[model samples]
Target chain A: MSADRLIKLELSKLNVHLPERRPSLREALSSARPQVVARDGSTHAFKREELEFLAGLLPEADRDKLQLPILIALEPKLGRGTARISGEAEVKVVSQVLEKEASAGELLIYRPEVAILRKKLPTTTQYLFLW
Target chain B: MAALAVSPTRMELLKLRQRVGLAQRGHDLLKEKMDALVIEFFEVLRRIQEARMKALEQLSVAHRALSMCFAIVGTLETKQASKETRRELQVEISTRHIMGIAVPAVEVREVERNALVRGYGLHMTSSVLDEASREFERALKLLIELAELEGSAFALARELEKTKRRVNALEYILIPRLKEALKFIMMRLDEMERENFSRLKRIKAMLEERG
Candidate 1:
């Protein structure tokens, strides 16, 4: 196979584990068992502890607005190692966890912060690749 | 004259050189990736070893507890309790990509902890058997987690080794041979052109002298 083709295949496989669509935080919390199906047809469950942490971050009204498995955007343009955390409540919670200053709207996190966020909320957060 | 004769073939040599450079870069990057994967694999393996030991120890403890319960409550009653207990334990398993490999996300429900949803007939029920069942159930959950982790670690390790071999082959053998072939072709092409140019010049001089 050509090098380009191999690289394309590798890049395509990077996000196969991501859910087609994320559930609302409220829906996830209310359900007896909260889980998502991956592209490869496997179920991934959300941890109760991570859900509770998310609950503590947002108001009751915002719970429905906030989505489970908050996307951590990994764009190549942002350089190889950096990632982004979007959404107001998601940013707030992540910022607090990483002990960083909370900015309004989206947050541009470096690689170390991204790693920390992932470590803290492995099930509740997922990496999103943007072209 | 020699320089002019070899000028046309220089372009091919330059192109071949660039290709070799790209291949070398790719090999280096892949080698680095393989090393990183090996490191990650070994780390996971270490964790798995610890988890396996702990889980097996806990399983044995639970089995011992169950045996003691059987002795106290009678064998038939303990067996009956085991049969009556709800074993609808579901694990929500999902795949997470580590590098290129898929690893399972095993999530087990807290089955044996629920007190209100009692199993077995009320008349035949003994708290000792329930305790035994619960202990065994807890151990099972831990064992399942350990199994998933160990399985993933092993799979990742195998993949890492395979990738390392490929990287080594490309770096140490294929790329080098291609470069050598390319160098030989360029040298031969240059020598042929030089000889052709010298022959042409001598013929031109002889014709001029004859004229």
Candidate 2:
């Protein structure tokens, strides 16, 4: 029973580091100090270099549509290591960065690919658990 | 193999199934965290390498400048200049999270200061001494950056090891054990039902024979 509670607690904490309200790419780029407040109330800052790299990937109009810290969703149903990236702007940027063909609104990447994406966009990408 | 001690009942089975589910979920999320941590750790390490190189080079330069100052103005005078100069440096240490782990983000005040801000007596401050001070100040800034990077790296590494351990326990111990116990209970329940059915048939046959 204690073990059950611990596992449940761990699961609950899996996504708590995620921001309650993620700062938009435009907001982050324009602000003097770009950061988001997590659900746990801790702040996460976006590096200026990462923001600039993200800006280079999209046109000015898409900056607002493109959220900062783009979430790479991991669902058990997707299998152990596969993750998905949704949102049109997010798909565009991820597909381009990974050099994969651009899909419409969603992109599915495997574990190794996810690692590469995280490596390239540390400040701009985060892992989000689903299901 | 580590079957949890429980009766072979439906209630225990239900609870065990739930535990397995929770374990699997925790394992998956922690694995993800581990992967993210690896990326973060490597990034810090790479930055540390660059910072280490720069800082080391600057330190050597500072040492050379100091040696020259020692030769130009006797050793005692150079030592006196260093004593009078401002030596207090405070790092503004805060934290940022990476996959739920709070790694530190340190900011140091402007380390490279002008001669006047260095707080050395102007009359006693020779050009050689100024040169040495300038080099050392630049080296200090680089060193501070290196320290921040190294600190973050160590924190990330510690968290990574912890997450990896949890993932391994779920994968190799808890989940497999729960599944094994679940199988054992299901098999026992099936065998019990079959034995009960056979006994009822035998009793009916005896009754028919007696009639």
The regions of model 2 sitting more than 4 angstroms off are A30-32
For B67-124, candidate 2 gives per-residue lDDT tens digits of 9999998899888877888887677888878888887777878877888888878877
DockQ of 1: 0.10
Best by lDDT: 2
Candidate 2's displacement at residue B23, Å, is: 1.7
B1-211 in candidate 1: lDDT tens per residue?
0121223366767866766665665555455445445545666676788888888888898888888888999888878876776667778877665554678767777756643365566776667777777788778888888978887887787778777776776777657665676767677888899999999999999999999
Task: Give residue B17's error in model 1 in angstroms.
Answer: 3.4
Q: In model 1, which residue pairs have backbone atoms overlapping below 3 Å?
A: none
Return the lDDT, model 1, position A44.
71
Query: TM-score, each model?
Result: 0.61, 0.91
Tens-place lDDT digits, model 2, residues A13-66: 889888888777899989999988888888888889999999999988999999
